[model samples]
Target: MWIESTLIAVFVMVLLLDWITLIVHCIVGVGLAWLAYSLTTEAPRLEHVTLIHLPIIFFAVVLGTLANYVTEVVRLEQERAMLATAGSIAHELRTPLLGIRSGAAGLRNFLPALLSAYQLARENSLPVVAIRRSHLATIEGVLERIETEANYSNAIIDILITNTRLPKLGHEDLSPCSMMRCIRIALERYPFSVDEISQIAPVTGNDFIFEGVELLMVHVIFNLLKNSLRHIAMTGKGEICIRAVSSSQCNQLVFRDTAAGIPSEVLPHIFKRFYSLPATGDNILGSGIGLAFCSEVVQAFGGTIECSSILGEFCEFSLKFPRIQS
Candidate 1:
């Protein structure tokens, strides 16, 4: 009956939980069974058998309980990690929301005044002063501001979904997406602060197409751009040069930033899930999931992404895809 029960337990537990977890439960279960057998079994040499089994049972129970305790501890730690990740993600979301609100506020103030001035001129047949380029820029900037913020928000949301869902790629959809188009779209969408856009130089006429989703590639590039931009801001040095070039074997997109680069030790771990650098000096929000998310997406698309950096010099990420036979 005990053996049958163990078999039944193993079968059901395997169906419900992972193998490692099931093994842990089995250890504890087996230990408890030994204890019960020693205490309640009707053996012929009752006292002698019980005496021998007592210490063994005790040791088994202790070992099993310790294993169970460790498992629970690991689970609690994971829960705490998830909480921290949620907090960081929430903080990131706020930046874009603030930008959207600020842009809307700018439009709110600028539009009414301009319309009123136009109405005044019509009513009194008075000449209106020439609008300054700065004034016109304000309106366009506000629109760009809103767009950039919205795009930033969407990128983060996609990262969050990818992290949470852990979805596997199956037969879904694929398309031929141009590399140059992706780079331009990410540049247009990223919420760059004043004067930050000037630092980016994207070389043109080096276009190639890959079989993948455009939005996914855009977000991946967004992650790279965001990291590069942040490092540039932090170190106050370097410019970002983006270009796409194809080789005989493969076509690749190069995102090279001449900024304070990643440390040699940190490079290997950058793409790990929930791995992030500590916040420092006004750069309050950071995420560990972005690069990991990019890796996951690119791998799912049947491609590769790699990063190399030299501290104080530059960091470059190359995303390569299978070359199409022309």
Candidate 2:
């Protein structure tokens, strides 16, 4: 009886999907029932009602009703499993990544000295041609890029952890912090080739301070750098110039890159969430939320970010934040 009651309830609930339709169905059913009662002197027989047809209708509706509930239950379970797995994976990854970063940092610190010693020994004991100048330069450049990419990868891992664990950005996270410090960290941690690194300019002022979450802003800057570097890499040569200066009421940071710039038609929609360029033959991949994320983060800090570009020439992003005096 309980099972039968549940089935009947499911049937009714399925039929009454919306208020307007439910009302119409209810009025129609009641009118038909009243007419049937008025016409029947004796109680209607099951034989005349056609039992086979009734069972088939009930069977189909009940099947769909239970299937809907089952699908919802499965979907919720899958979401819970995914969240748990993500947390576990982040924890597991952070440990090994920290070790790799430490090792790379150590190599970065001692690499120049090691290279110098090797050069001195080579000159003293062997012919200069034994170790070519171009080979040494290539090795140094490769090592530098490795170190830079290691730092960048660490920052990315940290961001992943933060995204998984941290709550939405709150007012407390927007306390006055050193903008110069964040910018410097972003530059150091951004993945750039040795050549691109050489072209970077210094911050214009010594007094750039702002109010925002340091970590999130770093990600914003990192995102911009990542996008620039990605397009630049496709061409195998590019230059990036970054400058930060204090204005009357705000501090402005300009990042300009001599890379394949965005198209005029595509530029307008670049900041839209999850809107990515179609994969052309070059295979420029993007999550599409990077620029959108940067825009949102800057807005959260009471700032503005704008981009200007000329295709095949350059792309420039200008960010302005209300200057907070120390």
Candidate 3:
């Protein structure tokens, strides 16, 4: 009987040891998994084997997700702070820029008058004949060009300010305008001209009258179109296609371009403020506010903007909006 009791005691001790080892293993696994997630760019995908660690793995995943969320929140806060600071500095600088531009324009306008007076004097007086009228004309032309450039700079600064200020949407009913029609209208208003409008199709959604800001939405579409055009123009032989389709629950508008596409490495940051891809060329103008504004507008309207591209083939952007229920 004593031997029997002794055997049972030994078995109980062994069972206790096994449970303790399992717990220790789980704690170790969770720590390692979390470390991996923290160090990598890729998201964590927990597997069935990971569940063998149970509560420990679950806590680790939760902690990892929380960590990621905190990181993003912090990043966004930093960006917001930077944007505010830059906007303030730009506002202060704009006053002087505007003054300079205005003075330059006034001087340019009076330059032609001054040249004409000089010519008249030269023609009227024998001693002044040595001053050639051509030299005076050249000086006037240079001043005019400088004034034109100053005006352009002021316009660019105005656009930057407009983009920095997040304007609220106007609650106006938008008619169910054809996606093609909207594209055509936006294109007409755009600064550049297109030889042809290719492969654009109709889309059904809330009429342009839906509750949103019409001008801002138009600006978003126009910006996307301009971006596509800029890329296609670079290729010298490319086209842009606009298409829209309505699924049961959502409506999608797609803009596809046949130009050399965006590189995969830069695709993710395309919508980020001031984040322009090097492959897009240094000469690409604008403050890199276009796509970022589009993203803001889409999100405001409860939609999403997504891009897909192949390095040498094509780039496509999809805008998805939830169908408005009557």
Candidate 4:
């Protein structure tokens, strides 16, 4: 079926492209045939040009169509090859990334105790451990940065995997998830710089729980946070707020950021699949799948996601989920 549809599409495109020539050929062929019949026939003689124009029209239509079809076929084949290569590369990179993430987790857990022991030894005046407290503090800071970057890398990998897998959101195990807990975990996992950390919103109500695919909820929140941070980094200062509330029929989570808000013209298309915003000096081009993916996942979980923004002021994303009764 796909092959048949593709062939038909290729034919239609080729015909559209060569329609003018085809029309001219038909007119010429018919006119010459009429002239030839007028000249040669007893009733009306016909000219030899009829023979020339008829074959020309036939050959032009057939050969021109074939050329267009082959060109399209080759272009599609090249695109297919490129996509396959990209998929292969992504697959190869995931293994090493998983190992690095695990190692980083171990180091993050071990480094604190090691630092504390060094501090204790220094306080007791042990000669070998008498390093400056400032030096120890610096090492601790570096370790923290390492852990943060590692988490950031892993989150990026998760996004890539999600994009590649295009995970269908339904039929997963649904579990009761606390909005407040998910927000805290996403913040901890997100790679916020030292100064940016000060701007994070405090967790709100603890009772706002709902049934969801917990891992997916985390990724959705992380994507929102990551986008906000990227925009905020342009101005060197901004705030992100996550507020949760319950209404009569739904539980609402509003994620607002005082970053470079989306332009009015661009705002309407933000959730469109593969539609990226134009890149400016401060922002990198996006794959444009993040928000679309979020929308799909939300819908699959029987929820709705919406966004509102005012350029240069703020952007807000609101997610509403149907509350499940215990």
Q: Please give each candidate's TM-score.
A: 0.59, 0.54, 0.57, 0.59
Q: Evaluate model 1: give its TM-score.
A: 0.59
Which lDDT values do the candidates have, in the order given? Answer: 0.72, 0.70, 0.64, 0.71
Cα distance off (Å), candidate 2, residue 20: 22
Model 1, position 24, has a per-residue lDDT of: 73
lDDT of 3: 0.64
Model 1, global lDDT: 0.72
Pick by TM-score: 1 or 2, better one: 1
For model 3, residues 1-326, the per-residue Cα lDDT tens digits are 43345335434433443434434554675588579777894766766754554565345444544555666689779877766775676678777777877787788778778777877777788455465657766786776566555654554454445556666654353334345456666665554432535422333344322234555666677667667767767776566777677677777778887787888988898887878766557332333667888888778777799999997788999988777677
Error of 2 at 13 (Å): 30
Clashing pairs in model 2, backbone N/Cα/C closer than 3 A: none
lDDT for each residue of candidate 1 in 40-111, tens digit (9 for 90 to 100):
876624466556655655554455555656776897689567756765676677676777767777777777
Off by over 4 Å in 4: 1-91, 95-148, 281-285
Provide backbone clash counts, one per model.
Answer: 0, 0, 9, 12
Stretches off by above 4 angstroms in model 2 are 1-92, 95-152, 160-166, 191-193, 280-285, 323-326
User: Candidate 4 on 29-87: residue-level lDDT in tens?
Assistant: 55895787678877764347655554654565677666766776897687456445645
